[model samples]
Target: MADLDRSSDDTSVDSREDTSQDSKLEFTEDEETLIARMYSLLGDRWSLIAGRIPGRTAEEIEKYWTSRYSTSE
Candidate 1:
């Protein structure tokens, strides 16, 4: 058993999602506030909004803003 080789070296191909649709997203209060304030201030301007939050991408900020706002209206 010790000499058997069963695992692939490519993590990108072998890895799978450990959770399902029911999995919850975990966020800090600061992250939540950052996104909220960015939206409130920038009104979904991806460039400006993403700039305010550290390490956030423009696409991600835009998607979150739209998803939250569209459902409320």
Candidate 2:
């Protein structure tokens, strides 16, 4: 029926949106704080700890750390 087709189309659209979102990684406030603090306390040497978090690159983590410190100073 036409109704079924519309419902399926909606589901497909929603799925595509979700997939697109998942392609980029987002950090929570807590995660940002934790990463920032860890970097601050240790300084640019986050390689060991960065391995634990999923979807985040070490470069991104380091850039965030530097940006936070630069603004605070």
Candidate 3:
């Protein structure tokens, strides 16, 4: 139906917007150091870690940590 097509198009546009927003998220040196220190203390407590940093969410912090540290072995 036309409504179904419109919904799918809206979903694609929303996904694109989400990707752009995520790509724009970058951490500063101080923020990275803080994340490291917090991780050591908290150990996968992303909500707690995110609370210490301004303008960052738990999901973003966790994604960064996983991408930067996780090994694909």
Candidate 4:
């Protein structure tokens, strides 16, 4: 039981660290422009779009786009 709690705590800490790190990601103007353009051309195909933007992963791009460009936002 103690071991299970410790493992769960570790998982929670790792997820918190991930979210904190993700919040720090910033896109350059050029990269943002490129991502927007690529999104327009490619639609919601994030992996394909990410390939065009160096140093950015698909997950990061998708998260940023959804947060900033989603219709609800």
Candidate 5:
């Protein structure tokens, strides 16, 4: 029982680390250019755009694009 608890705790910690890492989304200059070009060609097709960029998910790219480009109102 104690070992199982420890195992679960370790898994939880690992998942938390992964989540934190995923949240810190940093795009390089080349990636930014690619994203812009892809947006022009694809027009909001996030999944298709993400498929072209290695190690990026559609949600991450969409979030970055929105935060970087969205107009403040």
Candidate 6:
């Protein structure tokens, strides 16, 4: 299991640069405002939240939120 996790991490690192350059994960200022509003209104229902935002999917939103906002503690 540790090896599996490590391999996945390695893959992510290898792809990060190429993916980052072409990624659609970065939200615009207006989009950020709208997402915050939607998040407040909808809570953790990312799919519904994503539906309200064009050009963004639930997975992308969830990944961004997890990486940016979620705390270990």
Task: Give the best candidate by TM-score.
Answer: 5
- Model 4, span 1-73: residue lDDT tens: 9999999999999999898686548888898999999999999999999899877789999998999988962
Using all chains and alpha carbons, the TM-scores for the candidates as numbered come to 0.53, 0.49, 0.68, 0.65, 0.73, 0.63
After TM-score superposition, the amount by which residue 44's alpha carbon in candidate 1 deviates from its true location, in angstroms, is 1.5
Error of 2 at 33 (Å): 2.0
Q: Per-residue lDDT for 64 in model 2?
A: 62
Q: Write the per-residue lDDT of candidate 2 for residues 1-73, one digit (tens) a residue.
A: 9999999999999999898666535667877877867765777776754875666678767766666666653
Whichever of 1 and 3 has more lDDT, that candidate is 3
Clashes of 3: 0
Backbone clashes (count) for model 5: 0
Q: Write the per-residue lDDT of candidate 5 for residues 1-73, one digit (tens) a residue.
A: 9999999999999999898776558788999999999999999999999999988899999999999999998
Collision pairs in model 2: none
Q: Count the backbone clashes (under 3 Å) in each candidate.
A: 0, 0, 0, 0, 0, 0
- lDDT (0 to 1) per candidate: 0.62, 0.72, 0.92, 0.89, 0.93, 0.83
1-67 per-residue lDDT for model 6 (tens digits): 9999999999999898678746687878887787778888888899998898877889888887788
Q: Please state the error at residue 61 of candidate 6 in Å.
A: 0.7
Question: How does model 4 fare in lDDT?
Answer: 0.89
Model 5 residue runs over 4 Å out of place are 1-24
Model 5 steric clash pairs? none
Which regions of candidate 2 fall more than 4 Å away from where they truly are?
Answer: 1-26, 71-73
Task: Tell me the spans in candidate 3 whose CA falls farther than 4 Å from its real position.
Answer: 1-24
Across 1-73, the per-residue lDDT of candidate 3 in tens digits comes to: 9999999999999999898786647788899999999999989999999999978899999998999999998
TM-score of 6: 0.63
Candidate 6, position 60, lDDT:
85
TM-score: model 3 vs. ground truth: 0.68
